[model samples]
Target: MAGRFFSVFSRSLNQPFRSRLQGLMNYGLSCCVNALLQSFSATWELVDLLDRWNPVDKYKESVPLQLRKVLLAMQSDQSQPAPHQDFLHCLDRNYIRLHVQQDAVEVFLSILNLIQQQMSDKALAQEIQSLYKVTVETYLQCLECTYIESGTSFLLSLPMHIKESHNSLEDCIRLFFELQELRDRDNCYCERCGEKKPSKQRFRNSRGYTRKLHCKVTFPETLNISEILTAEALSQSYVQSDSQYSLCAVIVHSGDAMFGHYTAYVRHKKDQSWYYADDSNVRQVSWEEVQNTYGGSEREGTAYMLLYRRTPEGKQQEWSSG
Candidate 1:
């Protein structure tokens, strides 16, 4: 529950479970998880990787197993009650309590880490990880000692700061990789001088986080982050990696800090159309309608989290149901 981490941990505020989540054997009263489930079902790549995992022994309390099951159930003929009743048991074992407000981004990260840590097949798990992995190189330089240490790391969800009034997703992503001077509380330790000192920091590549800002953020249905990758990140790739991404899911948080609701705009993999999933109720929607979540006030919803898929250059997106 996002506050991994979106700042609105109170987004759930222990709210009532919304709509028995597809009116099936829903997972206790967690609309947050319900919304997340919708997004997960939309991610065909994740489903593909999870489906490939064949473990020698299956653990009863495994989150990935339960996730795989629930995702599969979600795709079954909607006429029958989906087998999500056991979802409650899985959450209980993992201590992912219900009836609580959780941040979407935070939950997203937690689930990703759970897959990484709990998967029985490490190789397949890494394949799942690579789908959302955002690799970056961090350069840290201490001002006083002029000692510099650089290392490569990766973020499952790149956190970016948004503007108060207006924002463009690209600009925010650019700023995420920009240089920053750390001082005072943010100062770093100087290895040579054996003391703390102000340091300059920069990231080679990255992206943003949500802070419940009631502002307008403009984004595209298909996103190309190639231009936004920092000079260092681009150099490292240097025409090797494709930078195009397709928006697959959007987790929307409606209402304000005290209380809220969670919904999702998912682009169906096979159907190739947007659909608004509100627990038990799901309806077709347009890209323009999806943009309504770009927040202008606390009363309305804003995109709390997003899921994008990397698309290879010059290739048509995977549109088949297989």
Candidate 2:
């Protein structure tokens, strides 16, 4: 019951990471997909899931097939490089067109959906989906009749909103679950009373544009979101499970919406060493260096998506800039 859910998207102590990560060549403005692949490489859990499954159809145009091959090829000891050309081509055929500045989250979700749709093994495909699922319950109350309706919902990722001023990750998460009251023009039709009435949505839940926020948002290397869990979500949980999340990988963006560069700071699965992957260049980086992505200006690289590993273990980060 450890709400051990991975979100789309934490500090380590002193440890020098020198493991050289294989870099992907930017084939036809493939930086966006390259960054995502780097992040996925760090997700050894996902790699293992795909490894356990045997694809019935090995079509070149199939996304999951290409992805499985690429992921396995990445871990190969063979000196031959694991070019993602076929994977990219498969993606292009799937309408994730080549040579376009793609949004990382959208691409990430699309990949997940494609796996579910295209994979022959339905059980294994669902196993992959359960790895990143977030469970929540919503409560809606009508003001006029005092009628109430509640339902459970699932989410794959959480999007954080940045303000013009200071921001904190904890505050952002709390705000996402904060109850909202709808009044005035915004009213819900109550089924019991058959009248439009003000309502309160208790429980709950970025776009684009080239405009960048210069706000300084503070995010932690280790996070525990159990405190923000709604009473309903918490009630269903009979076991007191650990919900601490450790920082694993972060996708950083630098530039406007039209023209931006994507890079990833990923933690090695075997060694827990941090490495930075930028297209064809791969270099070891420290935890502090990863924190630099917290942007206070347009020039500073901003964290686009963060990947965390839920753990019962305390922060075991050792900091030593290599």
Off by over 4 Å in 1: 1-27, 144-147, 203-211, 230-235, 238-240
Candidate 1 at residue 258, lDDT?
52
Misplaced by over 4 Å in model 2 are: 1-18, 77-81, 202-210, 228-235, 313-322
lDDT of the structure predicted as candidate 2? 0.74
Q: What digit string (tens of lDDT, one per residue) describes model 1 on residues 179-296?
A: 7888887778878878888888874322365335688887777767676765564546446446777787888988775567888887766557787877667677889999998788
Q: What lDDT, from 0 to 1, does candidate 1 have?
A: 0.70
Candidate 2, 13-40: lDDT as tens digits: 3535323467788888888998888877
Instruction: Give the distance in Å from residue 236's predicted Cα in candidate 2 to where it truly belongs.
Output: 3.6
How do the predictions measure up, each by TM-score? 0.84, 0.86
Evaluate residue 236 in candidate 2 and report its C-alpha lDDT on the 0 to 100 scale.
61
Cα error, candidate 1, residue 163 (Å): 2.3
